[model samples]
Target: MIKRIAYLTSPGPTDRRGVAPGIVTPGFQMEFVQIGTPTLVNDPADLMITDLAYVEAAMRAQRQGFDGIVIGAVADYGLCTIRASVDIPVFGCGQAGLLTAAGIGDKFGIVTIWPETTAFTYDRILRDNPVGRQCVSVRYVSTVAEQAEIADEDGFYQQMQAGREGMMLRILAEIEAAVAEGAQSIVLGCNCMSPVASILAARSSVPVIDPTAAGYRSLESMLLLGLTHAKDPRLPAVSERGPAFAEAVAAVVGTLDEPEECPVCVLDEYGNASCEAPSHEAAPTSADGTAQ
Candidate 1:
């Protein structure tokens, strides 16, 4: 039987969602979930909001009968929380790439786009550390301005084609720098860079891990083995915390304690609580400072 996989993208629908259809493997029916709005994950605070949303999506995915979950982003947003919340295996592209690379070679490095994304990719590598050793190096191949030109779905694909030889050369140069530092394998750190993995691998002597493909294969293997995350340390037993308490925790973590009826609630520009109503409002203030 074909496995049903929830492949969650870190960016909002407009950015990279269109490319998800091309990334799935043969034996899996993939359902893609976007994390949040494009502006929602621009910074660390926003990343936390996106992560919270991801956990909610994961719970829904489990109830909806997905056999496994895959996070397409390199940072692996909400990866652990979702794994703990559900019995199904959850794969993060960052971890997937690192583990796959480790099995193929001694040391690995990641090549990503833009400085912000470079930091995101490197931090995940540091956190996952699947190889048991630090990566040889982490490098960025594009500047913020350059990435801006190709941030859209069509532009991304257009830039990955042979017409953009200059961009490909820059990426190869960064990978070469990692090789100079003794990296024996390469992990394509951005999902948008998946299109070039084969090209990069063919040009080099070491294995090149395509982050999304690694994630899909890893999740597929786990499902075939009937293996989920470990129950002891990786996912401890759940406490008796009920729905009310869970909502409270979510409110605190997501900074979403504002009154739902308030119009401003729709505007969470910085992923924080929406603006409070005027003190003179007819609605009484709830104990939580929200209008009731």
Candidate 2:
């Protein structure tokens, strides 16, 4: 049977609007989804939006009947939350990138885009993977000015057309530096770097891993192995917290229709008969030991 997966991109809709999905390996069908709007230019604000959007998407993934979900960003926003919300496989690009590089060779380095995102990508990789210590360093491919230029559609394609000799030269330089730093392999730490990964691979003798491809392949492996993320401290199962869980979902995703009044009669935690307010602290948490 063909496995269906949802690939959720952390960027706003218009960032990669014209870019079409690449050819996927057989036996898997991927549907791409984006979180946030095109106007969210600031990295910090964009990340916050991506996180909330990721949570919303994660909630619907199971209901949508997807076999798994792959987070497209190297930062892997809302990865844990999504894993906890669904029984199917959940893949994070950052984790996959590092793990793939680790298996291929020891002492890998990351080549990411944008200086502002360097620290965030590094931190996420370390937090998600125990073998992250093998990652020696991270380097940038472009500055803010270059990034701004690439925002123009013509400029972006022009760079890609230039191949390794043109736009990819700086990134190649950084990858070489990693090799000097004892890095046996290199991981492309940004989803945006997918287009240039092959170029880097051809230019460098060592292995170069693309985070998005690594993440998707990781999902495929997990499915083939009949494995999913563990439901424990990393991704605890959700517990019903009175009507709040339903109510919150309803408020955001409209999972439930608003009651005309309070049709359903339910007793409060304090033995009070009303839905107006929690009669007491309500145990300070839910049955799953999570805060209500």
lDDT of each: 0.59, 0.59
Prediction 2 global C-alpha lDDT: 0.59
Per-residue lDDT of model 2, residues 1-292, tens digit only: 8888888753222233112356466788887654432112133443454455565666566667888888876777768767766678898877888888889887999876555434653665586788898988877665544433432434422354345366687778889999999899998766656766778898986899878788888887898899998888654464223244334433433322332111011122222212221111211110000000
Runs of candidate 2 with Cα error greater than 4 angstroms are: 10-25, 36-46, 153-164, 233-292
TM-score of model 1 (CA atoms): 0.72
Candidate 1, residue 52: lDDT: 69
As for model 2, its CA RMSD to the true structure in angstroms is 14.1
CA lDDT for candidate 1: 0.59
Displacement of the residue 249 alpha carbon in candidate 2, Å: 11
> What is candidate 2's CA lDDT for residue 254?
32
User: Estimated TM-score per prediction?
Assistant: 0.72, 0.72
Clashing pairs in 1: none
